[model samples]
Target chain A: MARTADVDDLVARARKGEPRAVARLITLIENASPQLREVMAALNPLAGRARVIGLTGAPGVGKSTSTNALVRAFRRQDLRVGVLAVDPSSPFTGGALLGDRVRMQDHASDAGVFIRSMASRGHLGGLAWAAPQAIRVLDAAGCDVVLVETVGVGQAEVEIASLADSTIVLVSPGMGDSIQAAKAGILEIADVFVVNKADRDGAQQTVRDLRNMIALAAPEGWKPPIVPTVAVKDEGVADVVQKLDEHLAWMEDSGELNRRRRARARDEIEAIAVTALRERMGDLHGHQRLDVLAEKVLDGSCDPYAAADELVEGLTESG
Target chain B: MARTADVDDLVARARKGEPRAVARLITLIENASPQLREVMAALNPLAGRARVIGLTGAPGVGKSTSTNALVRAFRRQDLRVGVLAVDPSSPFTGGALLGDRVRMQDHASDAGVFIRSMASRGHLGGLAWAAPQAIRVLDAAGCDVVLVETVGVGQAEVEIASLADSTIVLVSPGMGDSIQAAKAGILEIADVFVVNKADRDGAQQTVRDLRNMIALAAPEGWKPPIVPTVAVKDEGVADVVQKLDEHLAWMEDSGELNRRRRARARDEIEAIAVTALRERMGDLHGHQRLDVLAEKVLDGSCDPYAAADELVEGLTESG
Candidate 1:
């Protein structure tokens, strides 16, 4: 746990774009230290300034390569960038694979870039609870744009959408990658689609498949555009960046950006309250009141709903 | 919303092994009907009688095929079986794919087998909230065994483990399937591992990799055994069943089964309570209380934690 004074100093330094301070603040959030409330209090005013772009795709889709390319592109425009690559695989293992670190080292020498890998870590609310705070840290540290890259598997992609202002869903040609993306419900969360490995055969077909699916199922306001890119060779990378900028512009023009940030803030508040309540409930566990109620439900004297009602009542009355 | 009398009739019929009644009860749970309390009340006494086996693996690992084989194996013992194949893909579309339905038709004519596919549906609590109730319905409907099959992607697999007495994680040889499983944190939840497509090349290698990983892991008191099976050929499946039975026996003898069920009940009760709170909060949204608090947080007048404290206080005071 960090002391309040030290945390305040770290926040001040992070505001000045000190990498060590920024990393320390994120570590504090991840550990759920006693000083978290103070840190968030200090950092709250500095947040909501950076554009959060979420990049996601299935394994073997070159998401890391594309992320590196995007960082280089953003740097070329003289914009500071932050990357939060969430490793869904490293939760239980406690260590990330070597591949991502090696791929991201291209920007290691640049002071304008900050890269962090977040493991799922089995937190109470999962990554959804933690990523927002991390994004806030980067946003406060003066990154013009933050890229949250995650493996496009199941719930993670959806959670990423909630945290990102713009989401890019990447797919490569062949091996049923596009179909897998569709099945994973990637179509709903993607604001921009990228078909990487454009040198491969069927890249056009992959793009066509995405376009057709988008046309068939897209919502009323926006249509996701598919961009072809060979991320390794940096071909068509500029177009991807241009599309992202346009999407963000559209969001701002339509007032969707404010709505999204408000929703994000709302979710964060709710998650905090729920976590606090759960902690209260945990403190009540093994006590006489909850034990008796649980026993009743177990013995069929009451249904779980009724038991839950009683528990909630107990919490309120005790409060 | 269903009427109380109708819900009671459905519960009564479900207990008598009427398939339509069972299906109707499950539908009510899925839809979260107003009469759900009554149905759960009536079914509470009849639950805790079925063994829940969670089967999961990545796509193309032949999860459905293996589930079908397990259903057949259980039927040969003259035991009634219920299957809930959770379709993560079908939630947004509001319709389940025909693949699972077509595969499970082998037991369509058998009176003792019941299979239902559950779409993810983008529900408030996702599968974690709905699966327990569906399992209860099956338990009350007189299933000696229930199988919950889900795509072993990301968080869904972990959620399934919480609802089952035992979990079997299936993997096919090659395609880096085993590595993907490891990355997804499947090792923590797996009580038994089945290497499907045992006749394929690298079947032994997949088995070896799983064994090495399990050996390195192997949480205290139990070692997860790896079984190789060719589900299409119905080879080595009986051994899989035998392993499942052995695991259940071990859990019972060590009193782990009771502990797991108690934990499940606790989670179910907590989920219901939290959901109730969330619904109440949702109702308060756009109203002066929550909206004002949100504004304060957004404008940096207050931190999120403090706002959360106030919101929870308002909820308690109103209650």
Candidate 2:
């Protein structure tokens, strides 16, 4: 089959500030495909230009409201903002929820704002195969800040942290998961904590719980600030954004951003490597090499490691 | 440095039914090792022989206690059993603790029962890595059953379910994580559900809740029995054992045992093929290749998937 067109044209259009083209590029590769290869190739150059932040929590924790408010907040400052909300865990809808686009309509007319929902059907890891491409597309579009809001923690969304420069864990007051901030399985990955929906009754206690947990768990001198906000009212959101800037500033000041980005680069490399290796298991099968070696190892004719090493050497040398 | 003879000897001794040998083998590979290649080779033939089962939940959810009791239950029926208790999530003693042998002393003296604690240091998937080898040792040692216990939703433990013939998800009442059982990302993987510490309040409620949820969610026919058990007091351990035996029997009678085992063999083959690729990666200036690729992809000079596909094709074709 002929290779699909690279995302370069869409990127070119998007970079010209065409919102529809940008959204189309993201939509085209929102899942895994042969075309994702071309898109990712085109997208990589555009990354590292935007400050990418990730927001993640349980469903109905007001992540959409929080994300919408944040997008609006960034727009007020005349920044080109991109909002990519992840809804992968809701098994039925994939990750591209039409309702998400509806909620995002508040920013529809703003040429500075772009929103996309990444689907997780065949690719459960957020965008699965397409996420890195979408992020690249947005970056090329000159979005100064890109915010990714994952509706919940799943194998895919959690891995998103490895790619994010900064991660904000969204929690609510009455959710009974306050102390869970420490043991939320992904707490160790958070850079900032947002106590969304603080209008609820347990807001203060939730803040206290978060404070105590963060105080107890964070490495000495690496305290992550807990910002309380009623996102629906747009109250305290600017403060939340202010804290986000402070945290990013601290990451830069401490030389952590470069280190974290280096690690993120390494992780993406490994993930890609593993994926590629899985796709190429047949070369070892030709010449009846592995089958013979496997039989030998299975029967103790040769030591397993020696036989394995010999097989690799044989395949490589023969190659 | 020469590869350790200790790993090879310990694995052999463990396969020969030596408890101390099994314990030592578990401890040696529990940490990151350049020797994982040699050890895994030594372990390959011996793997895929035992019936591996995984149990997971929140901390203090009594996984160890339940595992200990389950082993005793198997012993009661004269079934030779091997228990691989995974304690690697956190350092019970700073990232390495192989103390389950001492804690499960009752079955320690019985040659038919081999218990080992796994401590994973750096390998993200080491839980599955160590497990298949350990289970192999037990299987070749003439063991009829092997149980692996882990906590929370982790990638390492999740791999166990794929390797195991049947998987059990262990949960307790008070933690209120039965909802976790419903949302327990691994619920789909469980063949049996055990509500441990059933003597506690809300045991019935936990069972009722799990059953209702299962009835709603389980496929048309399969409804995993949520066996209520006091694993500590041996209260419902017999029923669990009975259920396990019935499940195994059903599998054998229904031709599922052979079919599943054959599927596992294919997985074993695929896993070994991937491992072979990784070993080859170790030999190349892999770091150099990745760096070059990163630079190319960053500037959009090359696509990542194509680069990745090229990497794999180069290794296998040129190896």
Candidate 3:
């Protein structure tokens, strides 16, 4: 049987760079185990040490192709790379889960690259189960670069872009919806913008329109660069990578890096707290007579606010 | 000065179908006064009587245009229409907020049509501070049909969509991305889908791809129909309305309407409880010498989770 390690052992093994252990750890966290946040807290100090790059856009912006190409680019520098492509399970085919394995064929034998596809079941706002834990695993695996390829966002994808050290929003020519992106959170979230499919005729116009839109939307001094690429051919991958370096440098110089990282940490903490509270609601209720109180509040018998007030009041009064 | 009415008067005025009173009541609830939820409770029975339709998509998909066209179609039947447009500001705005206001000038003088733009002000999931109250106001305002126009959703928008009787996801014809909607929650949240700008050449392909995708993605029994339209010309608006009617019939025919509505109401009650708990966080901490507890938690001398437990435990132990 595959090793079924304890949570602490899993964390230790993951920290020591065991991919299997890391995967299990991610599953445990994503499933909201009773001890998940405690495990996360144990791993907290070790997190945020890795560079996370988020790739997102409407579907068909060549996000997966771009991710594959970027993996090659990073490997060319002899850097260990980790790829995470989130594929949602189809509702039909009796809950057919789209495994990313078929899409990332080349990386299977390459020990230097670890590619995992996640399912965003119950995923909201780009927040998927196990995502944070998965990110941590990659970080612990000592991967210098982690490329997160999302399930492509409709409007909710903003959540994915916000978590990355640098976010590249992919677009293409002839889509004719390039202008619409400026109005979406796409412009606000991108550290670098990529207009893929540079071979298309209207690509230049799309780039121009984007630059103009960014100019209008960008606060007077902050302008994110727009680059064109044919992701399938890996054309302009180097340029895209270089632009990312520039964006990171700019964020650091502008003191935005720490600010953003701190904000992300806070969001993580809050998300965990909220999730934790909900998870422990049953446990918490057992320690008190909450069910008794809640019933009274529900049937037009008493004020809910006052009942809630009594819960706290009773504690202070009796504790 | 605006007339300041109590919650009861406001509810009564709104129930009698006065737009001004409805707007005022919404303003009150959003402001988060002492009696907001109580007022919402009072108004709850009046809601769900109207057909609540939710419209969402990427920004600038002409969602508002489609909404307007649909609203006009409903109004032609002499049905009173109420629209809740979720704006970026809770009650104030500048720049694009102004642009948003400008685009919505057609019904500026219509009495039968009541329009209110709610600003969420970064409250994720796109809910206005006083949305439930606003919803009640619109419900009490005697609108036969109420359309909820989202600013854009990340996660909360998806959650909000569940509250609607019908949800139409609008998309443009020439999206660079292949997936009509990201395989995110939105893929499943939509009831009826529309690919706007049918005049565009790729519109048919977009619709076809969407139909094929939905056919593959939708669960066994609930396949949403995809409609193509030039919303600006009002082309296919009536068909869209007819499809919406058909969807309602399907829901009732399938025996899912009452179940879904009950579930949504239960969700509302649960959400209210959660929001109430958060709102009362300060109240729970009132004059309790919490700064020391907070300092200790921040300083890492005391665990944050432990501190919260201490508070909750202390509250109940006294009882």
Clashes of each: 1, 4, 15
TM-score of each: 0.96, 0.76, 0.75
Give DockQ for candidates 1 onward, in order.
Answer: 0.59, 0.25, 0.18
Give one digit per residue, the lDDT tens place, for model 1 in B203-239: 9999889988988776897789999999988999999
Q: After superposition, how far is residue A262 of candidate 3 from its true place, in Å?
A: 2.2
Residue A64 displacement (Å), model 2: 5.4
- Which candidate ranks first by TM-score, i.e. highest? 1
lDDT per residue for candidate 2 within A236-287, as digits (tens), equals 9998888889888988999888766655554455456655544433355663
Model 1 has a DockQ score of 0.59
- Which of 1 and 3 is ahead in lDDT? 1
- TM-score values for chain B across all models: 0.94, 0.83, 0.86
Off by over 4 Å in 1: A97-100, A175-179, A285-292, B88-94, B177-179, B285-288
Question: Which is the winner by TM-score between candidate 1 and candidate 3?
Answer: 1
**Alpha-carbon shift of residue A89 in model 2 (angstroms):** 6.3
Give the CA lDDT, 0 to 100, for residue B202 in model 3: 85
- Predicted candidate 2 versus true structure: per-residue lDDT over B1-319, tens digit per residue: 4357766776677678777776555555555456656666666666555666667665567877888888888888898888766644443332224355456567656888877666542345444345555566566665778887764553434555666777787878876555444433456767788899888998888888878777777554345778988888988888887777777787778776665554444444444445666555544575666666656565556666666655656686656
Write candidate 1's Cα lDDT for A1-319 as tens digits. 4567788899999998898898777777667666878888898888767899999987788998999999999999999999988865457323453554575579878999988877765677667667888888899899999999997777777788888899998889984855566777888989999999989999989988888888789577878888999999999999999999899889999998888887888788888877777667656754555566666766778788897798788778866
